[model samples]
Target: MTKRFLHITTLFVLMISVVLTGCGTEPAANDSGKLQVTATTGMIADLAQRVGGEHVEVSALMGPGIDPHLYKASQGDIQKLQQADIVLYNGLHLEGKMQEVFEQIGKQKPVVAVTDQFAESSLIASGVGGGTHDPHVWFDVKLWSGALDRIEAELIKNDAAHQADFEKNADAYREELAELDQYAREQLAQIPREGRVLVTAHDAFGYFGKAYDLEVVGLQGLSTDSEYGLKDVQNLVNLLVERKIKAVFVESSVPKKAIESVVKGAKAKGHDVKIGGELFSDAMGSAGTPEGTYPGMVRHNVDTIVKALK
Candidate 1:
């Protein structure tokens, strides 16, 4: 572990000690009688909101454009988790740095991973060793529907009185996801097979490529914490030139420099590859916007990819 992570862990332990001493019991529902749910990512937060409906007041720790892999919880974030009736995270090491914090808070209340319901066959291996699976399951619309079931189950378990309401909301939301899944399939099908390659700054879209039948290449590995060298850039440039690929996309959460370097390298190699558009990979767009919601984010990505590659 790096010095920063070690420092954060130390601070987290201290904070948790104080929180545990101050509160000996589970947090009660807010004045609105809604469960105070803390989710680690915007996608998971959206899931909690849709499934819990009026019974939940959801807060996302990692906001739009914030990369979860490198996110370290702050003392305030720890306080949020401590005060929450339940905590929800993407798990699968997506919030890698915050795992210890979650473990500590989990002892105090329900801490659930949205991807817990996924079978071994449903996950894609990161190939980074140690049997790690890719944590970006939300990219697959149908696969992400599993998260709805998990979240609804948790909400009902915590607030059993609202079981019927939660079930109703989940059914409605599932229909919307079914529609979004079909939209993604139809839209992404427009790209010709040869032009269906999606090159981005990182490997967060492996599930997306598998779901939509596109080939994905990333300059960086699964985590932005992973590094890339000059040779990696040259290799990607060569692939783009060889495949006659016209576009490369940058991610909102990751810096644009890496993809920019690839674009520069491609130009030098006589391949006119352009930065297709900014894609929401690890993060979503601003709150209150269409892209801020899960379905909107998926639609935006599908439209952007189709328009660029078609």
Candidate 2:
């Protein structure tokens, strides 16, 4: 079916389901009495769980190694969104295909773009133009902390009875994030100035480089859907050779072959760049692992980059 037709069908089904089931005006908590939060990505889900602690049960539509840029909502995902008390997502076209779904759901319930509160000046332009901004704001710990505030506000708006709980949780979580930001700074500083280059499979690390003061080069554009020709690979290879860069990292959400190609090309030119490590870009690591949570993922990326480049 056509993409537009599928979206329409999904919306129709969702509305019918909501009407038949009779969505109540009360907070949509589950039997356990926790606010049912549905987030578009794992990172946002982590934020919701952290800030909504003991009062919210969170689910992420896109999980580990899943790319939100090309993700289309499945019928199951629509059901999750329909059942959620509040929906959270990264804005700026991060969930490109699901924008219409979020819009439709917003008519019935609270749908929040966590990045909506950010100032225009704080965002990085995609440079591919058409006035697009990079959606990977979570790479910068301080910026991602802003999302906690937004999420907390929305939660309180939806469930005011627990405003105090949300506030306390948010404050504690913000403190953890503050420590993480400092840790990232001190660790990344170990890499000498000449070696502070981060070459990755895609341009997902622009915010990371900007936050951490590393020069980042990506083999592909912001979205994984963006195509990369031999010219792109060759250009990156040229940068690696010219700078004598020793490592290039792959992304968990993107194919490894892209960085592998860059490495092969660099090798062909005698630079000997190795695959530094896999960085969690659009996705986190598997569940129950250190690399799975946002702080852990950021720590993992920082440590990996420093180890390879320092």
Candidate 3:
């Protein structure tokens, strides 16, 4: 063959070899050069993973059932945050103890505070146990859809190549979350109006109750760290006695003792209040478990509440 022809033929073969060899199949766990992502909780981590797709390696500071409100970031956690390309956290003081650390990271990394992006008017006050916003947004799937969009925007900003993929996943996940909301409403519909009262260890489910037309009576405030005054516990127990409520729930993230106290007090007042199955309040189930996903977490809570109250 002529030299010119040979050179062109070689180049064409090389290009074809690269394509045929599946050179692009290893779809980049490091899409913008090994993006390290850290999320505050499992729910946020799951969203980050969906939005990041194969472009990012995501880690959550708070694992399933680990309360973000009281999470103390260890030395290793700091390193994760320091090295991460993007940091995702639910704002509104959901990570109460770790708030300052996350705030510090925001100055350096492409930190996206998901909850703060929502309207303040949408947040309900913690009522007597005063925190400005209720941060258990994942329980209310509609609210979480807004948060998911913010996460997608951040992922796109950090890794432009995955923008379309990120958007596609976001749209799909948003639809799923929307469906969860509808299902939640339907599941909750089974409960009678007076039986719709959800008394739990903390006020995390305020948004859930508001979204699903349930009455949420929380023993404590927004944070599990928020101490329940004697009067508050007494009032809850008294109410349970008077209302003839059968069950109260303890949170997986919060100590079970508190809810047990409520149960005991209710019994003393001539009422039978069982300690219902543990609910996911500030966090979710273990990483590999069904409740690790947003839909499963909310579904579990809805089913638990329905079984207890209905």
Local accuracy of candidate 3 as per-residue lDDT tens digits, 37-155: 88888889988887777777889888866877666656566556666778888887777644545544555557788886888777777555555667777777898888888988888
TM-scores of the candidates are 0.97, 0.92, 0.86
List candidate 3 stretches off by more than 4 Å. Answer: 1-32, 127-131
Q: What is the lDDT of residue 68 in candidate 2?
A: 84
Best by lDDT: 1
Error of 1 at 27 (Å): 2.0
Q: How would you encode candidate 1's per-residue C-alpha lDDT over 22-100 as one tens digit per residue?
A: 8776674468878999999999999999999888899999999899888877777877887799899998999866777
- Give the candidate order by descending lDDT: 1, 2, 3
Ten consecutive residues with minimal summed lDDT in candidate 2? 20-29
Record all residue pairs in model 1 with backbone atoms less than 3 Å apart, i.e. clashing.
none
Which structure is stronger by lDDT: 1 or 3?
Answer: 1
Clashing pairs in 2: none
Q: In lDDT terms, how accurate is model 3?
A: 0.78
